[model samples]
Each structure stands twice: as structure tokens, then as C-alpha cells.
Target: MRLKYYIIAIMALALTACSDFLEPDSISTFDTNYVFSNVDDARKGVNAIYVQFGVDGFRSRLSNNMTGNTDIERQSGWTSSGDRYQIWDLNALSSNGDLRQFWNAAYTAIRDANIAIEGIEASAALNSSDVLISKTMYHLLGEAYTLRAYWYSMLTYHFGDVPNVRLAPKAGNDFFLGKEDRNVILSQVIEDMMSIEEKMLWAEELPYGIEQVNREFTLGLIARIALQRGGYYLTPALNMERTSDYQTYYQIAKEYTEKLINLKDRPLPEDFRQVFLNNAKFVTPVNDDILFEVPFAIGNGDVGWNIGVTVQGGATASHNYGSGNNYMAIPPSYYYSFDTLDTRRDVTCAYYIVNTDFQEEFVNGGISNISQGKWSRYYLDAGPGASSAKGTGINWPMLRYADVLLMHAEAENELNGPTAAALESMARVRRRAFDSALWDEKVDNYLASISTSKEDFFDAIVNERAWEFGGEMIRKYELIRWGIYSEKMAETVQTLKDMADSAFEGTGPYADLPDYIYWKRNESGRFTVLNPNRKIAAAPDDTWTRESWLLGLRNEVTIYQEWITKDWRNYIDQGPKPGVARYIFPIPEEAVTNSQGVLANDGYGF
Candidate 1:
């Protein structure tokens, strides 16, 4: 039987609208006056908030490749001519549809929660049925609030200054304060969510893992937001500019997340692949470790069929059993980093693939042979019996219980710098990945990955995030929060190339670097276009800023231009240069056109 499921991405906050002046307030159309007469309406509203999870996951997954977040350097090839889909520019994104959907959905969710809040305040005591429904109200409302906070935090990280909206703005609501300070926005988000934290239970719903928000999720979210606000507004790695609010967030993160970690069910399962493959033994299931996760369903909405990079006999309607790469290729060094015994290396990327071109065996390229491999299954259809319309049932984890364990470990290490407990926590993940029996004895030996000094320990945690959580949204956050993404990209990409070149010195696989000629471009003005070549000794450490001279040849430049700007400083509270607007996602083109710009929060542009 085919099970149709949907992963509700409720916990989204909007693009902090760039400014308050971008849109005008709508009067008399929608009001909190007659908001909720029943519970289902409120539940649906809560569902809307969850939609942000979808937005976050899809955007994170696609961009992980194109964003230089991962070592998958062939992203430009995936977007080139004759390809299935072309990424024209950085701002023009594969996940834009989700962005558009998310903006509308999040606001609608806010409007619904606003209605519930208004109703709760206005009504009297309820019967038993009403009591359960009331608790649901607070739970969902709290979730909505948390999602709002999460979304806003994400915006502030990506863009910079975003318009902040608290209560739903009706004709009579306070519209005077349109553009609040980023800290002020963070404050409102935290306050609204924290208000309901005490009222909800910290339990995970069944089937879904720990990353799903519960009371524990509230605490974790608090920790995440607090840490981010601390880094961005104050206590930034370089101490660029410190917000008076830094201490507040730092303490909040310490307290709430510590409570979560100290819970009897704290710590993650030692296995690495099970976090993604086995939903039953989920880290959250083992204890309160799983804080929050987005839901996934097949043949549903935007996140439905044929959406990922898996090709050929892949689960999509257009498959002829010969199209698609089966799974996206990975860089060779990525696999080399894995110990032969480490389950994650195989679980994360496929080393090789098999195909028969003329009833004869043909081995073209595999993930290990390439740069980075796609980890998910690429069944052309479901059960090997159904058509492309039905795909293998696999749910991708946007956030997992393991991630929470790491987050707790990271937050703890950040505060104290170096502590055995923190180091032990980090090693627990790696030990399980390699050998569980040796966990207690051999785990202590991993200091080589990071080092022993306090400062070095902190650096180890950052590297741990990269080495352990590579390709996930966490890497970028780790780098930026640690104040090192620009440097790390330049360093790692180059390291990869040099490392590859060194390893393939005598190996036939990389002589003349047949896999790398196309990376080079000739911008010798006389011919301003690329002259294709594939003779690579190793993958080059090419990135956006590094490819300034060959902007047309690289996708890094394509994507970088979409988001990074001379305006990043403007979004910073006290930043000198202009910063990207951080708060709310720009109201999508349809949104402005639909409402004549009267309903948008502000600070949005194409």
C-alpha cells in the first residue's frame, strides 16, 4: 500500500522585510475581530507555520550544492546548457517557488495564531473537550511562535535587516512600528515563543524523530536563536561589534540548551547512518535528544516527486531508465576523508555506480571517483514495480536528533571553550560512526582532528561541524557565526584541489586531470568566453571571489552575486557598509500584485 505523507514545515520565520516603507497596511479586509470560532481553523493555521520547514529544507538542500557550502564543484555543470534545469542567476533560484509559498504561508499562519491568541484572551473557561482543544491551541500557537522566531533568525543570517512583525496587523493594530531593529526583532521573536514554552509539553509526536519541536524543541530553538543573535549582534568572532544583548542570549542559550542536554535522555545514538536511514531508532526516540525536524511526504506539494538530483531509473515521471545520474556525483576527496570502517562514508555518498550500455559492463564514474556523491536512493519508481510516478519511500531529515546532540555539544564548548564533557560529547558521534566498542577507550584519541588547547578545542568544534555535518545548513552557520566562512571556503576549496593534485600525482585517474579541464577558463579579452578543457590533476579550489576574472565560467559567482553584496554592512545594526536586508523574505511578486502592496510587512525587493 502506498502511504501518502506530508512533512509539515511549520517553523518558518519570514524574510525580515528590508524596510517598513516597502508595503502599506491593509485596512478593513482581514481582522482579528472574528478570527477563530473553532479549533480546526486554528490547527490549520498552525499547519501553515510548519510549511516553513519545507522552505528551509528545499532551499538548504539545493543551495548546499550551489552555495559553495559543500565540496560538490560540478554545480555549474548541472546548470549548464542542455541540462534538465538551468540556474540562470544566483537570485533566480530553484527554491524560489518555496520562498514565494513560504512568505504567504507564514503570514497566513501568523494571522491564524493571532486569531487564536485573540480568542483565548477573550473567552471564558471551557469544558473537557474545549480544554484539550485549548491545550492544542497553546501548543500549536507556541509552535507557530517558535517557527516565526526560527524563520526570522534564518533571515537575519542570510540577508541582514528584515522587517519584523509581531501580532497580525489588522486595520486597528499597531502599524506605526514597521521597521524594528534586528535585536528588537529577535527580542520579539524570543519573547513570543518563550511565553508559551512553559505551557507546552516537550514530547515528540510519534513516527517523527526528536528534531521535531516539543517543549525540548522550544529550549533548543531558544538556544539556537540565542547563539546566533550573540554571534551576529554581539561577541562576533572578531569582536566586530558587540550588542549589549549578547550576554542575554549567551546566557539564555546556556541555560535552556543545558536543561535539554541534561535531561535523562540526553546524548545521541553512536551510529552515524541510522540518524538518516533508521527513523525508528531515531536519536529523539532514544531520549529528548531530537529537538525539531521538518516533515516529508511523497507525491504531496512542492517537495514532491522528482525534486532532488537523483536521475536515471530515478523516481520521476520522465525517466526512461537511462536518464539522470542515479544520484549526484560527489568529490573524490570527500570519500577519502572517511575511514574505510566509517559507515557514514558509504551512507553519505556512493563510491561507484553500475550500468550496461550494450549488454556489457560499463563503469563510468561513481561518487568516490568523482567529488561528492548523493546519498539518497534513486529507485526509478516505487517497489521496483510501480512507474516513475511512485518513488522509493525515503524521508530526508532536515534536522535530526543527532544534530541536536551536536548543537548542545557546540553550545557548551562555545561557552567554556574546552571541556572534557564537550569533547566527549563530540567524540560520541564519531566513535559511533567508526566503532562503538572502542567508544570509551578510543574516543579520546580523536584530538588529532582538532587538537587539545582550549582555543584549539573550539576550532575543533568548528571543524567537527564541517567534517561531521558537512552539506547541512549547520556548516555555513558554524563558519559565519565563528566568523570564518569566507576564509574557510577559500581555504577548503584550495585544500581540496591541492590535496587531489597531490594524491593523483602518479595515478592514471587524474593524470593531466581529465576530470578537471573544464574548470579552467580563458578570459584573455580577445575571446571573453571559456575554452573548454578537462585535464585536471585535481579539483581546483575555485569559488566566487576567486573566479572574479572568470565570472562567466563559474556558478559560485552566479550564486554569490544573487545574495552577497556591498550592502551587507547596512543590514548590521551598527554596521558601516550597506548590508543585505535580513528580516522578512521579500513579499513575492505575486504577493504584491495580489494585494496591491497593501499587505506586505516591508523591505522586500526582487
Candidate 2:
């Protein structure tokens, strides 16, 4: 029951391709009456909504490449002028191709979901006397609602107040529409998901399990979007603001997350690395750590191609694990921020890559180029081919159970000031991060120290999320909702500067940190490093190879690399509004032109 195979089989028959942002090509020729007459075709109609995820818009760009310059994940886009680099630099123009692709894909998916919802609601199969037929139709209806809501959630945040298209395309329907208020769009989707989530089936009950949108994912998404609605966002005037009744949304977030915890809770996986390794190995089990993932079929995803540890391979290479490069690198400051005893540190950051000779070697770039160590094509059980690069068939995780626990903790702390319920939820997530022998100090004592005040607990949650989900590309949205997007980026710039200064002058905050690291392969033929956390005078023996660590932050004539100094310059101080990141980008020029007189590029100096 692999969902991707079904989706691929039905895409051409059920989905309509869009000619522009909102105009679907030959949609009027689609026969919805026959498609939604039964459970089988209705399921195919719903599966079409997921086709957008496999395209260039999401497969390579939106998932990982476009979500950089955050506090944890980074890429110095100052030296490049490509479409993705422009986005990473936080100055994307109206003609940016990446934005155009994602914008069109989102609207196209929304249109497909709209068709499914309309057709499924009108079908008589929903009220059929056969219980299995009736129940299955209801689940398909819920999937339509949840999938449409997911696209809207991403749209409103990326491009504020996008056109809200809720109806299926028709010959006489009004295609030209104005931008709807984002708050209104979010509220509508939140209500839409809430009304249908309970009627949906759980993952285990569904044929595709976690590959399809189930009740657990819907419930978790309600909480996730409620937090986004209650949290801060940039306005057209370029000021961060939240609704006056923000606590109501927080309450919604709290209740929905608690409902999932009480009804369908599963223990977090004891091993942190296995959560992502499961994705690489194509081992998807329902009701486990991951709630839902985009099920990309063979030769259709960009997981290892653009977002994992670099693997150098080609026709001349010995191994067949094809070349892959991480567009988003882990920041050195983020690597240093982790506790030495924490098990997640080594799994989240890697300084070595698979060389062309099929051997592990240090990355050529300095400290700034450390690859995200979560998933790589090298981790695949079998390589695609020697010259393969683009598609690894790996699924992209959308939500996890750890996020639900943290969301519950955050909401309860905000409303009730770190009560016992809040403390317990936080502790549950922390316990799995450490061994039982060390839980007394790492979990128990750590919770006690952060529970003194509400604000303290919130800060702890922020830091805990950074450590727990470092390599994942969701930090940009989290920082934006917390109203610290620019603040954190500025802090990262200063931290890098301080590390560079300390390495050169030999007396500062990071002076005790290592200026050089020594490494050698162990008996198991694995790369091993010494003095990764502290300074050392010399290697233990000549068997070790030494490389400059923090000292690489500076070069011959400059205090730091030019790209490092200019990494987040506009996002910090030179954006549309100084000291504020203009998170909203303009709608693509083609979209605006196609809107007739209904849309305009008007706010944040667009």
C-alpha cells in the first residue's frame, strides 16, 4: 500500500495542469461526476493534491533549499545571484523563478483539492447503505479538507494575504480575485480542519498508514496552525503583530494537541537517529514517531540530492552512491551550542563527506561548510547508480510526535505558567534524548531549572527545539512566529565575529574553544575527531591529521570571510525596514499580470 505508487498511477487521469497561477488548463473537460461516484476514483482525486510536492517547487526548493539563513541552518548567498540564493539572501525580486514555481504549485494543489471536495460532497456514496463505502468516503472528504488547509497555511506565511481560491475551477467562475487577509484565511482553515478531523480515521486504520493524511496528522496540524495564528507575523506595514485574542488560539493549540496525546499517543523512539534513518531506509510504520510524510516514489525526490551530507560520485568513482551536495550547511555556532554529552550533537552535524574514492574525508570548506548529518544518499541500503544525483526516493517528514509534545508544553506554559502538566510534557521529550543513567541531571534537573517562571520555560522550549531539530528546515517559520527572526540572525552574525576574534587574539569568550582539531580513522574505518569541544596544544601522536577549526573563520587579510560578514546584512539592518526582516515577498510578476486589476505589489516596499 505504498501511496506514491498509487499517486503516480492516477495523476494523469485525475489532476489538471495549470497554465498560470490560477487558471487551470482544460479543467472544464474534467469529468468529476464519474470520478467521485465511488470510493476508488474519489481516492484518486484526493491523491492528486499531493502531486505538487514532487515538483521542482517543493521537491528541491521549498523543502530545504529556500529555508536558509536561519540561526541553525545557513548558506552564504552573498557570492551567488541565482534564484535560490536571492531567497536565502532575503531579497527575492518579483521575477524570481523559484517563487513563481512554488506559488503556481500551491495554487494548483489547492485547485485540485477544491475539485475533490466539491465532487466528493455531491456524491451519493457518502450516504450509501454500505457502511464501509460510507465510512471511506468520509475519510476521503477529510483528506481533501486537510490537504487544502496545509497549502493555505504555507501560502499565507510565505506570501502574506495571497488570493484564497476555495472553489473548483469552472468556465464561468471568477478567476480574478484580490488578496484575502491572512488572518481570515488562517481562521477559515483552522475551522475547516476542526470540523472534520474527528470524523477521519487514524493512520493504522487507513490502507496507506502514515503516507496518507490521517486523523492524528489533522489534529496535530490544527495545533500547528493555531500556534501560527496566535503567534506574531509581519504586517503590510512591516511591523510584527499578533491578534488581541491570541490566547484563544493558544487554547485551541493546547486542547487539540492534548486530545491527540490522550487518544493516540505513542512513545517517542528511544533512539533519536532512527527517526530519520527510517525515512532513508524506506521503513514507514504507522503510529510511530513520524505523524505524516510526503511519500515520494522512486526517482522522484530531492532528499539526498540537495539537502543531505555531500557525497562525491560519478562514472569514474568506485562506489555507486551518486553525488549529492547540501545547499544548507550547519553553522559552527549552532554546533558549539550543543552539550558535549547530548547524543543528538554528533548525529545532527557532520564535518566529513564521502569522497570520490568511496572513502570518508574532511569537507574541503572550512567550519562554515559543515553538512547537516541527518540523511544522506550514502546511508541508502543500495545506491541508485554511479551517475545518479537528483532523485533518491526518500520521503520528507512533515510532522512528528516530538513536535506535538513541545507544542502542548508551549501552549500550557503560556496560559498557565508552567504547571505540572506543562512540566511533564517537556520532561517526556527530554527523557528520550539522554540515557536512563543520566536522566536525573539532564531531564529532571534541567526541567526544574527552567520551570521557575513562564518566560524562562518558554526560552527553554526555544533552545530545546533548536537542539532537537537542528538539521530540519522548519526553524525559519518557528523564528518568524516567535517574533525573533531578525534578532536571532543578528545574534548569529555577532557570534561568528566573536569566534573569529577569539581565535586570532587568543583571549575572549571562545578562547577556550578549539583553534584546531585533530582526527584519524578508527579500527572500524570511521572518522574520529579529538579536541572537538576544547582547545588542545598538540595531537597525541603523528597518526592524527590536524586541520584549522575556528581559526578558519579568518583569512590572510580579512577578520572574517567577506561572505560571512555579509551573510545576513539585509535581513538584520538593510531590509525594507531597518532592523526588521521583510518576510513577505511580492507576488510573481506573471501572477500579478494575470490578476487583471485584482492584485498589486504593494507593501513592504515591493
Candidate 3:
């Protein structure tokens, strides 16, 4: 069962609110002594940090809407000039409201965490003679540290080198600050997580389970941020580079992932689909596939609303489930890239929508707009009413055990050239992707092929991540760190063109792929399709309905949709530096105005 700790506890911290982005009159005076004097109040102080996750900044924008234009997940933002479109198109201005919302929310959460951390450290309860009180206090302190690190990690990656505000707000404190190096911020947070993770309890020991941050998640985060610190990043000079001591960070990743695997290990859940179904079903089991997920209440989060399968209905519609649509669509290339027998393919990519009639129907444009199939309100046990669209209450998965295993494999390979340990780690994740019957061919042999060289293994990891975590919205950051964001986007564009040419001309590498698909509901009323992998001369029966598939990629005037061809042009050729993604966004106008000459939007052509 999930707890209402965060929601119920945050109200007490309202009077002690800190200004977003540390403006003057930053911290309103509050009685910190009373709040941290006992274990219960201290827990409330920490819970306030999680309140930000339920806000619009993370619930919709940062989590799903703004993270797009990747090889797998995409949105054609070329036509619209809205705030979200500006972000999707990678040309967000300083005044873009979406960026400002996330920026402000992250800093607000950071400020709350800072207050809790300081209060907990100074609290007399921390050193209480009673074992229970002392242990609980220590755990609360760790929670504060981990939460603060999480916010810093998001801020640095999204805006690049944001001001490092480490102290709790006070009247005399210096609020105005300038950007620090992103590496410095990442390094600091990584160290912060590392310091407290060992002292924190595991998920099973905690009442909230995977719904809240625990030792395992913090340990995994250490490796994750370490890899990010070690990986390539865009510099002020518009160059893609990593620090000379990058290997040190990689070693940190290797050590921490290794530590987690050794001290506390869990097998990847065999049924990948059930992993997400559990989230929608509100069944969060401890020591399972997920390490930590942001626990949004029933009236919060945009999981199924904006990031899952398209559900078309409204207040006046026949169905009571209301409406939801995927802001980011799966590229047909990504859909076809999956192995035909892979179970993850169907679960990760959906070509149908829950229509207004509450019946499954093929998406209007077919291959042009394949929605994410992982989760949807249609899968909910009960509807939230026909007028509902914004919140589905499905928890957003922050980290999974599969990611930990993959990170272990990647870090091991980078440090020691695809060692036996590395191959085993990769194989563990792949083993779950396929069935036991095909393990020898799909898992063992595939691992053997990729283990030929370090480069081959690394490439396999990249492809594996795309297939494993499609629709999860972490692909953009992964590509950036891999220094292949532009290369992959360019490749995706060309692949789309090839797919279009083959379907239009009926003679190319993808000619075997069907131009149109024949689909029908099965006896169980589940949507099924024929010729998903290759072309067929005709449908086997009249029961099947035909729809344009690959053929939909082109029209009379263009080989592919103009949006497809122009989708990543700026990311590939016209960014701040050619062939490099301009990962940094301009500091929000409000933040710049509040900085009092300490900050400006200057680098990366801002």
C-alpha cells in the first residue's frame, strides 16, 4: 500500500517557504527548532522536498512533454511556437514558460531539501541515546541529502551549470549567484549521495517501499551521475567534450554499481509489461523491478495522460475514462528495429488508440504516429471520470533494476573491455527480454556476438537501452552523454527516408516491409495485426481491416512528411555548433532579472 506521507506532511512547511531561484527575502523565517526537535516533524520537513514532483514542472513538462526529438521518441514541433514546442524543437527562448516552470520547481525543491538537511544535522534528536530515534533521524538526514542531489542533477543536466545553492535560506545569506561548472555541480551531488546512501535503509525496511527514495536508488544514482560526469557534455565554446579525469568518474560508476550488485541485488522482473502495469494498477512491491518511482497521488502526475497510449474520449463521449494522448510518438524505424520475437516490442510500441466508442482503433495516420503502449488510463481498473485528462495517478518510474544491471555492464566494459562480469550483466537483462525457450539463441549467442570488442559491446548497450527504455523519456540525456545525439538523429532521419522510398518505389532494402497493415480484434478483443514484419500479397480473411502503414510516410509531393525531414535539422546541422546538439537552454528571463548582474544568458549562443 502507498502512503500519503508527502501530501499530508508538506502543509506544515508552507510557512517556511523559500523563494524560487533564491531571490531577495529568499527564506521566510520559521521555527526550525520545533520542526526538527522530534522524529515526526523532521520526516515532514523531508517530505516537503517531494512535493515538487506532483507539480506541473515535473508531472508533465520535465517528465514527458519536454523530453523529445530523440531517435525513438519524437514530436514534430516545427509548426507550433508554443512553450513546449520551443523545447521539443530545441530552440527554447529565455521567456519559454515550460523551462521556467521546471527551473523554478527544481530550485524550490532544492531549497526545501537544504532546509531539512541543515535542520536535521543540527537537531538534538540526531544524537539521541535511544537506538530507534537515532537510526530514524539518520535515515531522515539521508533522505534530505538524496532528494537535494536529485534536484541538482536535474538542474545541471537541463540548464547546465546552474548556481550551487547548498545552504538553507537566511536573511543575511547571499542569494545572487552565477553558474558553476556543470561538472562541479554533478561531482558535488554524486559525493553527497555517496555519503548518505550507506547509512540509509533499503526499500523493504521503509514503509513506503519503492514509492520513496531508498538506499538502493541512491546507490544506483551515484553510478548514474558518475557516468554522466564522466561522459561527454556540451561546453561553453559549443564543443562536445569530457573532462581529462573522465575515467575517474567512470571508475566511480563502476565501483558504486558493483557495490550495489554485491550488497543488495534483485533479479530483473521476468514480465516487463507487468512492471509498468503494476504502476497503473497501484501495486508497488518492495525489492522488485523498480528501485524508486516518484509517488504522485491520485490527483497528480501525467503518466497515462501525456506519455502513454492515446485514449480518445472526453466529457461528452460514450466512455467514462476521458481522454489522453501521447505527446511523443514512436518512430516507425524504432518500432521495426526490434527483433520480431522480442516481447518488449509490443509493450513498448502501440499503433492503436482507445477510440471515443471505447473500442480499439488503428491510429489515423498509422506509422506516422505510433503511441507508447506501456501504460494508459484505458488500462486503469476504474475510470477517473469522462472530464479527466491531466492526471492518471500512475507513478513515474525513476529507476529500475534493469537500468542498474545495464549501467553495471556499461561501466565494466568501459573500464575493462567487456569482461566476463560485464557480459553476464548484459546477458541478465537480455535473458528477461526473451523467453526461456529462446535463451540460447537470443541471449547467449547475441551476447557472444557483441562481446567481440569493447566498441561492439558499447554499441549493443546503446541499442539495448533504446529497446529497453523506449517511451521512458531518458533517451535524450543518454544520447547527449554518449556524444551521439546529432549522429543518431541524423541516422533516424535518413532511415525514415529509406523507409519512405522503399514503400513508395516498392524496391529497396525495406521493400519486404508492408506498405499497409491488416488488423483485427482477437477472440479476447485484443488488437492484433498481420504483416507487422513483412509484406503479404493479401489478407488471410475479410475480418481484417487494412490501413496505410509504411506508405503513410510519403505523399504526392514529398518522399517523407516535411516535418520528418526537418525534424532534427537544427539538432544536426544548425545548432550552436555544427553536428552537436545545443543541450543548454537560455536562463529564464525572470531568473536573469533576479540575478542582479550575477548571471546572464551568454553561452551556447544564448
Candidate 4:
């Protein structure tokens, strides 16, 4: 049952030396009969697949880059050069270092999964003498297939059509097969998952619970995959295509999401913040709504330490796990975009208070001071500055009930316009983000204001998703599928430009703050707000100078001034045009060259 401990050594049994790097070699000499001979070893084989979740490029790097550079989150100005910057700048090349890491990690996982599936299936055949395969054996095989499907899902999502390896590759095997179409890979993956849905254990039944993949996670993934395939994707041919029958995929997504939603005791959590705070506090999810998560341990991999306070700057050793590198941040415009009433805004953003550490004072160092707090170390069990660098023991949820509700609303609206069922689902998630006492009336009023048209309702879903899953890494993929990644980023650029020019005077959140003034904490220990009218104040000392003190400790200015002066504009279009190639990443250069003409780096040749 303690499978995590065994993940470290599981890969040793399957690897072998080979000439072609792309041609994965699983040692034919290793005895599959022994590895999957019993339930315990079979479980370990599955454990190996989960181990890859904690690997560098697989979870940390991918999640960081995918979620880090949208309109909501921006790359820090400090780390200006690197693969992370390439991803944020939307100009990722085939040679980007982390892109190569992501490529190698995903295919390696796929190769391991193929080996596990072959080993488990062969072991099951050898046990045919038994009247039926043991329940443990069935679950083991079910998990193996699900894991394989999950890895393939990642491959298709990022790299478009990739080599589909369903079987273990031995010494003389041709692992250098040409890439398969994405739809082709997704079909195989969907079929493989559907076949095992009934045999796997549900989240409610698992002894280890959310630490491992459960039936709900499998079902959620089915919906996610179907919805993705059902939606538009950029292909290597440099054209967008609905690779699958979209209506069928949408229906599949709808059915699975609704089924997951109506499960006997599962429902949306009463509060939105608890979804993450629970993970930060317990490091293990006990919430009913969390269907599946990637588990972490004290020493296994650097999953938690690499996110949150470690990267979000402004973290002092006093308030977080050591000092932050200021590597990732949210733009001031993004921070201002939120409605002041939404509880999620505060939890997601950390507004900069004035700093007077040196002879001169500053306001959030201008725009560079804003950062995210969703994964802050302040929420971890060890609290800020947990003595070790290994990683905080926090399990990251891959799927949540709120997402199902949102997806359900989206698909239902697409299928039959705006129905009461779809509207209600959207309301439920929105209501949770506000004050509970006022939510009922406020949410109803807000819903009534939205046009009943399908397009209007769909736009509501788009905005809600950005607010709901801001730092969770779901937004980038959503924008790409909606076919507006380029337009949205362009719009955000203009919006920031306007805000910067006006010194944020009339902006909803930043309106009342002065263009420049002093700030200091009051008796209640909260920072006092400066008057917007101070520019022409009767008091002569109320001037917009760095030396002026107006009832506070340090001079302050609206964040917009900083946005215009900083290098914020460069985040949007640092490379080529926003075309089909921009939506999908280029296959790593090493991967293509090493494949010896078997692999084509078509759309990503740049």
C-alpha cells in the first residue's frame, strides 16, 4: 500500500542501452514474469508511472510555464534570459532548454508506461489457470492503462502528433516510428481509459484516497480529453482543425462531468480558498471535491518548493520559506482586473505595501512588486522557512469538482445555448467566490444582467475560468482552445498601456490612490489609503514628489506609472506572428535530429 517508497527504483528494471536515442530500449533480458508476478510488484510498476509526475520537466516546469505567462501572471523582470522566459515571451524555440526537458520527460514517461502495460498483460496471461484474475490484478492493470493514457494526453496536448508507443520496445524493435496524428493518439487513449473505468477504484473507495489516481480522476480526465479533442487545436499543417467529431466529444465530456458531479457525496466546496489552503496545510487532501492529485513526499522530488513563495518575489525570510527569487509575478493590471468583492482576488494576489528599508522609499517597487500567494509557504505546515530545500510535502490536485461544473456549463451552452441547468452550474461556482451571506442575492443579480444569448453566456464562462483558476495553470490551454490566445494577449497589452498612461486614476481598484504620495500603517496595523484629490490639495505639502510625507511613512504612486516605465510590453510579442505554430510548441531539436528522418519538426522549424 505504501507505493511511493518504491517509485525510486522501479525504472531500473525497464531501461537498457541503445544506439538510437529516440528508439527507446527496454531490456529484453529483464523478466516481466518476475516484476508483475504478484499484486505488490505490479502495484510498484504502476508506482513508477506516478513517480514521473514529480520529475522536473513533467510537473514543475510545465505547470509553471503554462500558467506563469498569461494575462493573469507574468514573468519577473529579474530572470530575463532562459527557457522560462522563452515560454513567457511566447517565442519558445525547439532549442529552449526546458522545452527539451519537457520533451524528454514526457516520452520517457510514455516509454515506461508501454513497458508496464506489456508486463502487466503478460503476467495476467500466465495466471489464466486461476478462475478469474484477482481483484488486485484487475486494478493494477486498470491503473497501468490509465497512466499510459494520461502520458499520451500530455504528449498530444503540447507537441501535437507524436509517436504513439502502445507496446514495450525490445532490443531490435523499431521505436523510430513516424509520428501518429493527435486525434489518432487521443482515440486510442480515450478507448483505453473507457475500457478500464468500471474496474478501477473510485476516490471514495481508495485506502490511500487522493494520493493516488482514482475512478473519479479517470472519469474527469475522460471529460477533459474529450472536451479538448472536441475543441479546435492547431495542427502541424498550420491550420486549426476540429480533429474529432466535436458534438460527440462535447457530449462525452458533458456526460462524464455530470456523472462525476452527481456522485453520492461529492459537491462543490463551500469556499474557493479552502481547495488550495487544504493542500497547503495538510499536504494531503481530505476534501471530498478533490478527485485526484499528484502525491509528494519529504525527499522524493521538488514539487512544492519550486512554486509559490520560492518564485513569487517579495517573500522575506520573515514571512516565507527563506527569500523569494522574484522569478514569477502577476502584472498590476491583472491585479486591478479583479472585482474588489471577489474573495479569490486577495487570495490569488499579494499587493505590494510601501517599503522604506533604505534612505529612499518605494511603492511595491512599482509594478514589479505584485506576486501570487496561492501556493505560498505561509500556508504550509512547516510555515515560512521550512528548514529543508527538498520540497514542502504538498499534493497538487489535477482535477477538481469546480472545474467539472465550469466545463459542464461550457459544453451544455455549446450544445443547446443557455439552459437553466448550465446557468445554475455557473452560478454555484461564482457564488462560492463571494461572501456567502450576500452571494445568493449578488449572484442572482449578476446572472440576470448577463444576456441570455449563448455567446454571452460563453463569454461569462471564459471570464469566470480566468478568475477561478488564475494561478492553477488551466488558463493557457483554455485560451488556446477558445481560439483567442493571440487576441486576448493583444487586448491585455493595450489595456495595460492605457492604464499606465492615466497613472491608474480612474481604474476601479486603483482609482482612489494618489498618483504619488506617502503611506504608513495605521493604529489597526493596516496601510492607510492616500487621497486621489491630493494633486490639488489645499495643503501645499501634498505634492507628487519622492520627498513628500502625507500622513504615512513612505511615498506611493498608482501601479500604472510603473507598468509604462518597466519592460512589461515585451512579455506579449517577443518573437514571430501569433499563428498556428504559436499555439503548439516546437518539437525539441534534439528529438527530431536524433530520430533520423523518422520524426519531422514541421511547423516548428523556426
Name model 1 segments beyond 4 Å from true.
Answer: 1-41, 51-74, 77-134, 173-178, 204-212, 233-247, 264-267, 279-290, 301-311, 314-330, 353-381, 384-394, 440-442, 447-451, 504-606
Best-matching candidate per lDDT: 2
lDDT for predicted candidate 1 compared with the true structure? 0.44
lDDT of 2 by residue, 38-103 (tens): 998888888888888988998898888887888899887777888988888888889999999989
Model 4, residue pairs in steric clash: 321-385, 517-556, 519-553
| Model 4: lDDT to the true structure | 0.64
What order do you get sorting by lDDT, best first?
A: 2, 3, 4, 1
* Cα TM-score per model: 0.67, 0.98, 0.98, 0.84
Better of 1 and 4 by lDDT: 4
Q: Which stretches of candidate 4 lie over 4 Å from their true place?
A: 1-21, 76-79, 125-133, 300-304, 310-320, 352-366, 383-390, 504-575, 578-581
Per-residue CA lDDT of model 3 for 123-238, tens digit only, reads 99999998889888888888888888888877877788889999887777889988999899999988888878877889999989898888899888999899899999888788
Clashing pairs in 2: none
Off by over 4 Å in 2: 5-7, 11-14, 28-30
Pull out the clashing pairs in model 3. Answer: none
- Ten-residue region with minimum lDDT total, candidate 2: 5-14
